[model samples]
Target: MAFTGFGGSTSGTTDFTQELVSATGLAERDRPADLRVWPNPTPDGTFTIDAGEARILGLEVLDASGRLVRSLGALSAAPFTMELGGLGAGSYTVRLLTDRGPAVARLLRQ
Candidate 1:
């Protein structure tokens, strides 16, 4: 599967959804080379993403079924706090775009 950049869809909703699902699935499959996420199953309110030596450009949170829940823009440092209070109780994926590569972590809401 190919990686698709983040954007809205003007095409058919079904096609767009499929493409997004495929792209996000592919991204989750390939782990980042240098980033890390602490407290594996994250607490419901906040969490951190550590980029190690890499620079984190942004972060995206996805629901269990691969739906985009939130996009965190332009992190200023290696470890950044993300608010998860509005998220529903379930499993979520946190994807980080770093200087090294993309990093993905599974977050659990309690």
Candidate 2:
């Protein structure tokens, strides 16, 4: 699937409901790859993002209120480590942009 870009409501805040999509002819449910976040429920706020065979292009971490808290602009690696030590303990959403498509995973900081 080819990820065109971010799209959502016109209210202002970005809605990440449309996780992945196909720009060509593939179906919407056809995901090119799987995005994995390990060490979930992290105690130290450190975790890893693994995109399987897909290469990670960008990464974003959003708070529970849908506010962007952390972002790693453009990247070219996978299975990398990230630390959220500065952020308060709470639930966050992790969004990773990959060559195949966009992958999202829930993260818990403690």
Best by lDDT: 2
Model 2 TM-score, 2 decimals? 0.70
Model 1 is weakest, by summed lDDT over 10 consecutive residues, at 12-21
Instruction: Write model 1 residue lDDT over 6-101, tens digit each, in one string.
Output: 455678443322233453554552545465666666655577778776777888999999999999777886677778777778888888887667
For all predicted structures, in order, the TM-scores are: 0.64, 0.70
lDDT for each residue of candidate 2 in 1-110, tens digit (9 for 90 to 100): 43446776778877443434545666644566588887989999999888888777888999999999999976666678999978999999999887788889999998
Cα error, residue 59 of model 2, in Å, equals: 0.6
List where candidate 1 sits over 4 angstroms from the true fold.
1-31
Off by over 4 Å in 2: 1-30
lDDT of all predictions, in order shown?
0.73, 0.83
Error of 2 at 100 (Å): 0.8
Clash pairs, model 1 backbone? none
